[model samples]
Target: MADETRATALRVGASEIRADAQAKAEGREAYAADCYPQGLLWAGAVRPGARHGLAHARIRSIDTRMATAMPGVVKVLTARDVPGTNRQGIVHKDMPVLADQKLRYAGDPVALVIAESPEALRAALCRVEVELEPLPAVCDPVAALATNAPRLHEERADNLLGAAEIRRGDGAEALASCDVVVAGEYSTPVQAHGFIETENGVACYAPDGTLTLTLSTQAPFRDRLEIAHALGLPFERIRVIAPCLGGGFGGKDGATVQCLLALAALNSGGRPVKMHWDREENLLAGYRRHACRIEYRLGARHDGTLQALHCRLVYDTGAYAHLGAEVMALGMEHAGGALSHPQCSDRRSVRLHQ
Candidate 1:
């Protein structure tokens, strides 16, 4: 093959043509949010309205009677409708797909409303009243570990989810011996993936007792396992198809609408169901990157050679334990020698303050 006549060499300095760029630029791209099939019912989640006031609270009651009676509303579902564990998470299945007994955060889903029309879905969502009993929110990570702070999980003694760390080569002693030592703590806020596509998916319940899910997701295969586990359905019965994402940005890696949409499809009586999160809903219900506080003490030779590194990290997982501990482990391991991240560490309080 001649070098100049080759296909790869035909376009060196010329403008390149892309398959999707033109359509996307001309606003002709078909996104998951734009997926509207015939006779599909609309599903919208009813979130805790109480979070506007408190960082944490207990659900006294979720009043869905008004929503049930609304025109064009098909069904109203709660956690009780979910089967099996009713929990969703890749690494830790601690977060409930729907808040059954209590509302952890203000954005926790308390109700799922299916409607014949989008307008009906909106109206039903507004009518689903949620009464919350306020609790002392563990807003402070350090204070959350206090002897008397409210426990987020009944099984957990304190508010600490868990921790991951690594240590090697007497780094603490090495830091002291180093000619130059720098000790500082840096904190990072909870960052959103902020993808243009806000967790949207379409699901259909087949008459043959199978569920088909089509959506914009980064993890379709994992979503099948999550859906089946949470809904108590046979894993083989759920079919997942991931269309090209409008935007995922890692936010779609976890369960956002997968379980909820499947549940809606189950109750819809073989009808096609669509659940598209609006900007406001996405902002409230979407996944957030861990808000981490990192305390690092770096010691190095005066001649600028890397020597010792000591770091402590605390991450706020918000209401649910997402990939919090794993994220910490990744950062910690990147800086030190191999050490297993701690799981179920027995209580022995360490306080730096007198």
Candidate 2:
């Protein structure tokens, strides 16, 4: 028995076996996506521009009458149905839980539906029609920076979400003194998280008014405050439970279904509410890594000694500021190469556009 116990004990520099490996390999381990509580209602959001290609538009009206009349649908909620501020974000509270006025992106939620069944949820969501007045949309980062470009957020003056500059020493002067200089322009496209599990969660509002959520998320603790602020619930009354995630890759670092699920629970008549973003919906609404354009200029002496580095980075943060400034800051920090440089200057801009 002692020998068997020793075999399972952890040791330094030893290959520690994962306890859940066997269950996962056998498809027996239950993930958050696998959670379906009894008496749970299905919740889904209606994105006005998802199928119509209207990236930028003014929401004229949201028709939820037909959806509300559905047989199994419990409730159809719009921005007015939201309790509190209805806004949520990490650094900037610019994103609305449900778009009340304007549709900045095709993925912005216009209406939320709660149903007794998945079929009812789908049928009800389809019935929730939205009339939008299309507006000009800027896709490219450079074009978005133009003075005349359309602004996604009216509160902001320009399409630039955030900007920062890092200077170590005399960057341009040192580059001019170098014997060799190389310049290049590089661009990367928007990439999705594509997590196998997608974004899924379940929430319940207890009789004591505690909102408990079980989700497959990377930032469970942060989700608590996001839900609280969006739904007007007290932070102490909210509970977030993070189960084993199939994959996150930084995409689940923000609220996905946290606010929506809580909203559903609030109107679910004390029953639990579940929300699962399908493959298409996940691709449509999931947070993406910023697509960026980099203008890099490197200076080196004739003997190959690195002298100075200067780079300008412009990031496309889509229609919302979801950690856009922080992401740009990280890009600027890594602009310098592995070696130390006497002079380095990095400028970064986060653009808000489709």
Candidate 3:
């Protein structure tokens, strides 16, 4: 019935042309991902290689001599170049803008290469050498919580990032009095956004020491804060302009090319710098929907009236804590629609527990 109402309402005035349809269809729309300032120096990353593998490892040494000597390669930057916090995240500032001490994921960037052209940037990135030391890694969540499992962050004692609960009425007591009950275990696999435009951005550091950035991002204002905080620059000095995007779909909701590209521009001697991830890079580094495991028990009266609901949900945010806690909270809001299930008392919702 609710679905019918929603569909009916949409049909009345739906099918209206989109605001960006004409510009997009005419190929006249300018996307932040496609922004290119004049005299743009391309920037690329040199990722840690095979010694320690992608699952986990520790950084031993980074050798950028060869890449730095490349004809067009301007500067080879590492953790040494990053100032201020050197960490970036929407909520938790745990993810390193440049991987310094640990390589949490296979996609962790070890170094940034700035060059005069895309060809030079790619060549320089390939020439950069890195050495890694293998460490005991806990790839599985169940194993990660083990007493002896390797700690991803030495500061953190366990792999359990967080937990949550929702509640209403005497949930357990209500379930005990129910006439019908069903319980099940459910799981969902991770799904990628596969956005068409990929991740890309352009940034410029002006002679006046202020910075301006135009990029394909969902939150431009937030990007300004992230860049300012991560790079140790004044927040007011940075201007983030999001022209438009071919597509973002939450993948661009957080920092993607903002901080790193800004770092490149900082050292580009007033020249604009650009960073655009290719298809392969995006798939490995881009954000995706969290895979989840849920245990739910539903109780109801013999008359088909829902009496109570109890559910536990787990969200695997992967290498970084992107919107893990927030996403889980949203799913718990409905508890698979049990909140709308009719109740015997005036109370119409199930409760949540930690």
TM-score of every candidate relative to the true structure = 0.88, 0.95, 0.89
Q: What is the TM-score of candidate 1?
A: 0.88
Better-scoring candidate (lDDT), 2 or 3 = 2
The digit string of per-residue lDDT tens for model 1 on 129-205 reads 88887877766666666788777777666677675444446666777787898888787887887888888889998
Off by over 4 Å in 3: 1-17, 49-52, 340-354
lDDT of 3 at 65: 98
**Which whole-number lDDT from 0 to 100 does residue 157 have in model 3?**
63
lDDT of 2 at 128: 92
Give all candidates' CA lDDT scores.
Answer: 0.78, 0.88, 0.80
Kindly list the per-residue Cα lDDT of model 2 for residues 49-147, writing each as its tens digit. Answer: 886898899999999999999899999999999999999999788889999999888899999999999999989989998999999987788999889
Which scores higher on lDDT, 1 or 3?
3
How many residue pairs clash (N, CA or C atoms closer than 3 angstroms) in each of the candidate models, in the order given?
0, 0, 8
Which structure is stronger by TM-score: 1 or 3?
3
Candidate achieving the largest lDDT: 2
Cα-based RMSD of candidate 1: 5.1
Sort order, TM-score high to low: 2, 3, 1
